[model samples]
Target: MNDFLLYEKTGGVVILTMNRPEQRNALSSVEICEEFEDRCRSIERDPSVNALIITGAGPVFCAGGDIKKMRDRSGFAPAKTVIDTRDSYRNSIHRIPKALYNLEVPTIAAVNGAAIGAGLDLACMCDMRISATHAVFAESFIKLGIVPGDGGAWFLPRIVGYSMACEMALTGVQIDAEEARRIGLVSRVVDGAALMEQALELARRIDAMPGRTLRLTKRLLRDSGQLSLDHHLEMAGAFQTISHETEDHREALAAVFEKRAPSFSNR
Candidate 1:
């Protein structure tokens, strides 16, 4: 059977693609959500992979949750069907971002085209985003008479500031890659065909860096966002103490003093 989400391995990076191009790759079918989440979970099975890139096949990223499919139900209440779809989308995450959130690695979203509704929320899951110049983001839920589900409201405010987040949320605006970059929605915007190339280059650069420290830093940053300064310092200090004892840390410090590149084996 063809995979709804395609998985590819590149060095320390895992690339995941939404494989349904026929419907602009929308997660409208219930089966697609299950399949997509399965692929995401499978990618996390590899220990050597340190980062991930999520994109979609075809010219469009995802057309939100499959609005057409959900609405086509013969007699189901429209609102109830939407709520069901929202639940499915929430469950489809496979606890992956929470893993990515704590995975001591990074994730990048190479938004190649329009990222709508749940699609836009999916992009927000990553730690970084690099999109095609023509990519668009739509917070389209309000137009459908439903609220943004799947963490869009949560991630947008965190990354772009409350004021900007308020504007995006209230307007349900479709932002272009340039505007996305301007308001911090994405980190970089490249030509359509070059999005993945640039993302891998970035993943390679990140993968080449120290893995242990990156993990520790990820934890530190997560804590910093919620913990008080003293609490965060205490957390970082604990991590630093544990980190300094690692052989990789010793090698990195020694290499820094000796004026040579540090060879890290994640020891």
Candidate 2:
């Protein structure tokens, strides 16, 4: 609800914009993390929302943690004690990944500019990523003499593989949009002006699908990474059974036979 995070819904696509342009939309305070968790809860409760797009408001997508706050020994950095630092990460920034990973809706990250440290991990949390040509990314925690405390270790390797993730995390070097695409960090890169346009177009395509099926598919994919082949197939079968019983499934089949566009209720 705060101005730091802006939420807008169009049809089944929801846009969540980080609005702190002045600080380059840094995750500088507890408020930003809390607002993000609250918004995820709202999105989960809203049955009408089938897809989400996350982006930043200004030139930089996110500068990651607030360097200024770190310098002052305030905010999420430089806790008074080691235990306090651990608690800070657990209670604050960790909530974003927990909420987003469990979110049923399809999510996209439109990286408009710089995505450093935790910002890079944030994009990795989404189902897909599209970047502006001017956008840059870095696993920059090493440069600050800290490890990735915000799930970058978990998210980065899955997207860019172990070697690349290790290189990025160890070196803390920046990669441009084209390099990001080459390494499979981003699916595509476009002009800065076209960033949102491309992201919304992708969101609209996903929004046109049945909401229940979309959620189920995302769940299956998430589980697939952890489950054995046999177990995954069994899970897929169970979900398929449920999918077949949905009214939207029947409508889709009927439309196919009738040679017409399917009218999905998103049931």
Off by over 4 Å in 2: none
Best by TM-score: 2
lDDT of 2 by residue, 1-267 (tens): 567888899999999999999989999877788898999999998888999999999899988998888888898856589889888888889999998999999999999999999999999999999999999999999999999999999989989999999999999999999999999999999999989999999999998889999999999998788899999999999999999999999999999999998988977
The 10-residue segment with the lowest total lDDT in model 2: 70-79
Q: Mind giving the per-residue lDDT tens digits that candidate 1 earns over 1-267?
A: 347778888777888888888888876654565565555565555556677788899998877776665577422123456677456555654343454454446788889999998788778878889999999998778887877756678777888899987787788888899999998889999999888899999988887776767767877876688999999999989999988888888898899999999887765
Evaluated at residue 165, the lDDT of candidate 2 is: 96
lDDT on C-alpha atoms for all candidate structures:
0.76, 0.92
Query: After superposition on all CA atoms, what RMSD does each candidate show versus the true structure?
Result: 3.1, 1.0
Off by over 4 Å in 1: 29-45, 73-102
Best by lDDT: 2
